[model samples]
Target: MGAGLARFARNRMALFGAAILLGLLLLVLATPALFPGDPFRLVGPALQPPGGRFLLGTDTLGRDVAAQIAYGARTSLLIGVGATLGAILFGVIVGGLAGYYRGAVEIVLMRVTEFFQTIPAFVLAILIVAILSPSVTSEIIAIAAVSWPGIARLVRGEFAALGGREFILACTGLGASDARIIFRHMLPNCTAPIIAVGSLLIGTAILIEAGLAFLGLGDPNVMSWGLIISAGRAVLRSAWWICTFPGIAILLTVLAINLVGDGLNEALNPRLRER
Candidate 1:
C-alpha cells in the first residue's frame, strides 16, 4: 500500500486532480458557512456578470451562481458517491454469488447483467428517474441501476478466474466454507481492480446526474450545476458566464475524477506499476 501510494503521488496529473478534488471538498464543507440561506433564493440583480457583488455572477432570476455551485457541489458529490457505492455493493453481492456458485447461478445472474448492458445506460437512467420522479434519492437509484452491470461483470470475471487457482482449491480441500473463502480470501484480492473501476464510475455517475439535471429531472427545490445551466441555456449568448462556470465545474470535476481513476488503475495494477 505504501508503494502504491508512492506511485500515485508521482503522477503529476493525478496530483493536480487530487488538488482540484481537495478544493472542491473544501468548498462543499464550507458551503453552509460561505453561502447561508436557500441557494435558489433571488439574491442579486438579474443577468449580473462576474463582479464584486456576485463572485461568479447571477442568473436571469438574480440568483447567485456561486451559491448555486456551492450547493450543487453537495448534490453532485452525493449522487456520484452514493450511486457508485450502491452499484458496487449490489454488483459484488450478485456477481460474487454467481461467480462463486457458478452453474445455474452464473447463468441467471450473467443473463440479467447482460440485459442491463444491452440497453443504453443514459436511456435506462432517464427511464428510471422518470418512473421514480426526480429527486436526489431517485437520481442515485437511477444511476446505480444503470451502472451496476459493469461492476457485476468485473466481479464475476475476477471471481471466475480466482476460482480455478490453487489457493482456492486448497481452501476448499481444507474444509473452508464457501462464504468464508469468498469473503475472507477471494474478495480481498479483487479490491484493487474494484477500486480502480469505482473511481471512474464516480465520474460517470456525476456526468449522468448532471445530464439528468440539465433535462430538468433533478430535485426542483434545490440548486444544482445542471439546473443552473438549464436556466441559462436560453440566454447563453448574452449571459455566457451563467452556464459557462457551471459547465466548467462539471468538466473540471469529471476530468479530475478520471485522472485520479487512471492513476489508481496504474498504481493498483502490478503490470502498470513500473510505468
Candidate 2:
C-alpha cells in the first residue's frame, strides 16, 4: 500500500489535483464556522456591488452573496458525495451479480442498464424528479438512478475481463462460493477502474445537481451554487456579483473534481503507462 502511494505521489498533476479537492472539502466542512453572517440575512442594501463589508456584494434580497457562496459549498458537497456513493453501491452489487453469475441474470441486468443508458441523463433525472417530489432527496435519487448504469457497465466489463483470470479461476476451482469469489477475488482486482469512475462521477453528480437547481427544480431553501446562479440570472445585468461569484464557485469545484478524476484515470490505467 505504501509503495503504491509512493508511485501515486510521483504523478505531480494527481498530487496537485488531490490537494485542490482536499481544500474544497475542508472549505465546505468549515463554512458554517468560518462565515459569520446568515446566508439569508438582509443586513446589506439590495443589489450592492462588490465592495467593503459584503465582499462579493449583495443580492436583490439584500442577502450577502459571499455568505451564500460559502454555504453553497456544503450543498454541492452533499449532493456530489451522496450521489456518487449511491451510484457506486448500486453499480457494484448489480454488476458483481451479473458478471459472476452470467446467463439470465447477466442478460437482464445488462438490458436494464442499456435501457437507462439509452436515455439522456438530464431528461431522465428531470422526468423521475418531476414524477415524485422535487426536493434534495429526489434530486439525489434521480441522479443516482441514472448515474449507476454507466458505473454498472464499467464494473461489468471489468468483472468479465477479470473473471477468467488465473486467480479467479483458481478460487472457483477451490469450491469457493460465488459470493466469496465475486467479492474477495474478482472485486478487489477491479478497484482501479471503479475508483477512477467513482472520482469522475463525483464531478458529474455535482454538475447534474447544479443543472437541476438552475432549472428551478432543486430545493428552494437550499443555498447551492446552482441556486445562487438561478436567483442571480434575473438581475445579472445590474448585479453581476449575483451570478459571477456563484459561477466561479461552480467552475472551480467542477474543475477540481475533473482534475482529480483525470489524474486517477491516468494513474490507474496500465495502457497509459509512461515510457
Candidate 3:
C-alpha cells in the first residue's frame, strides 16, 4: 500500500489530476457558503454573457451559470460516487462467489453477467431510468445495473487466478472457512486492481449520469452539468457560455478521473511498476 502510494505520488500527471479533482471537490463543498444563491431561481436577465456580475454568466432562465455548475458538481459527484459504490458492491459479491466456488456457481453467475454485457450499457441505462422514473436515485440504479458486469468480470478473473495460489491453498489447509479464505486471504491480494478499476468506474458513472441528464432523463430538481448543457443547446449560437462552461467542467473532471485511474493502474500493477 505504501509503495503504491509512493509510486502514485511520483507520477506528475496523477498529481495534476488529483489537484484538479481536489479543487473541484473544494468548489462543490464551498459553493453554498461562498455563493449563497439559488441555482434554479432567476437571479438576473436571461442570456447574459460572462463578465461583471456572473462569473460564468446567466442561463436562458436567468439563473447563475456559475452556481449551476457548482451545484451541478455536487449532483454529478453524488451520483458518480453513489452509483460506483453500488456497482462495486454488487460486482464483488457476484464475482467473488463465482470465482471462489467455480463450477455451477461460476456458470450461472457468468451467464447472468454475460446477459447484461450483451446489452449496450448506455441504452440499457436509458431504458432502466425511463422505466424507474427520471431521478438521481434512478440514475444511480441504472448506472449500477449496467456497470456491474465489467467489474464482475474483473473480480471473477482475479479470484479465479488467486484461488489456485499457494497462499490460498495454505489458508484452505489451515481450516479457514470459505468466506474467510475468499474475503480475508483472497480479496486483499487483488484489492489494488479493484481500487484502480473502481476509480475508473466512478468516471464512467459520472459520464452516464451526464448522458442521461442530457437526454432529459436526469432528476428535474437537481442542477447537473448535463442539464445545463441540455438547457443551453438551443441557444448555443447566442449564449455559448451557458453550455461551454459546464461542458468544460465535465470534460476536465472526467479527464482528471481517468488520469488518476491510469496512474493507479500503473502504480498497483507490479509488472507496470517494474517497467
Candidate 4:
C-alpha cells in the first residue's frame, strides 16, 4: 500500500489532478462560509459579464455564476459519489455471488449483466430518471442502474480468476464458509482492481449526471453545472461566461478524475508497477 501510494505520488499528472480535485473539494466545503449569499437568489442584473462585482458574472436570472458553480459542485460530487457507491454495492454482490458459486448462478448473473450492457448507458439512465420523476435520488439511481453492469463484469472476472487460486482453495480446505472466503479473503485481494475501476466509475457517474441535468432531467431544486449550462444556452451568444465557466468546471473535474483513475490503475497493478 505504501509502495503504491509512493508510485501514485510520483506520477506528475496524477499529482496535479489530485491537487485540482482537492482544491475543488475545499472550495465546495468553504462555499457557505466564504460566499454566504444564496446561490439561487437574484444578486444582480441579468446576463452580466465577468466583472469586478461578480467574479464569474451573473446568469439569465441574475444569480451569481460563481455561487451557482460552488453550489453545483456539491450536487455533482454528491451524485457522482452516491451513484458510484450504489453501483459498486450492486456490482460486488452480484459478481461475488456469481463468481463464488459459478454454475447456473454465474450463467444467470452474467446474462443479466449482459442485458444491461446491451442497452446504451445514457439512454438507459434517461429512461430510469424519467420513470422515477427526475429528482436527485432518481438521478443517482438512474446512473447507478446504468453503470453497475460494467463493474459487475469486472468483479465477476476478478472473482472467477481468483476463485481457482491456491489461496482460495486453501481457505476452502480449512472449512471456511463461502461467505467468509468470499468476503474475508477474495474481496480484499480484489480491492486494488475495484478501487481503480471505482475511481473511473465516479467520473462516468458525474458525466451521466451532467448529461441528465443538461437534458432537463436534473433535480429542480439543485444548482448543477449542467443545469447552469442549460439555463444559459438560450443567451449563450450574448452571455458566454454563464455557460463557459460551468462547462470548464465539468471538463476539468472529469479530466482530473480520469487522470487519478489512470494513476490508480498503474499503481495498483503489480505488473504495471514492476514495468
The alpha-carbon root-mean-square deviation between model 2 and the true structure, to one decimal in Å, is 1.6
Against the reference, the lDDT scores of all candidates come to 0.94, 0.85, 0.93, 0.93
TM-score of every candidate: 0.98, 0.95, 0.98, 0.98
TM-score of decoy 1 = 0.98
Task: Superpose all Cα atoms of candidate 1 onto the true structure and report the RMSD in Å to 1 decimal.
Answer: 1.0
Tens-digit lDDT track for model 1 on 52-153?
989999999999999999999999999999999999999999889888999998999999999999999999999999999999999999999999989999
Estimate candidate 3's RMSD in Å: 0.9
CA error at residue 250 for candidate 2, angstroms: 1.0
Q: What is candidate 4's TM-score against the reference?
A: 0.98
> What is candidate 1's CA lDDT for residue 17?
93
Compared with the true structure, the alpha-carbon lDDT of candidate 3 equals 0.93
Q: Is candidate 1 or candidate 2 better by lDDT?
A: 1
RMSD of each: 1.0, 1.6, 0.9, 0.8
By TM-score, is 1 or 2 better? 1
Q: What tens digits encode model 2's per-residue C-alpha lDDT throughout 156-178?
A: 88888888889888888889998
Where in model 4 is the C-alpha error above 4 Å? none
Candidate 2 Cα misplacement greater than 4 A, ranges: none
- So what's the TM-score on candidate 3? 0.98
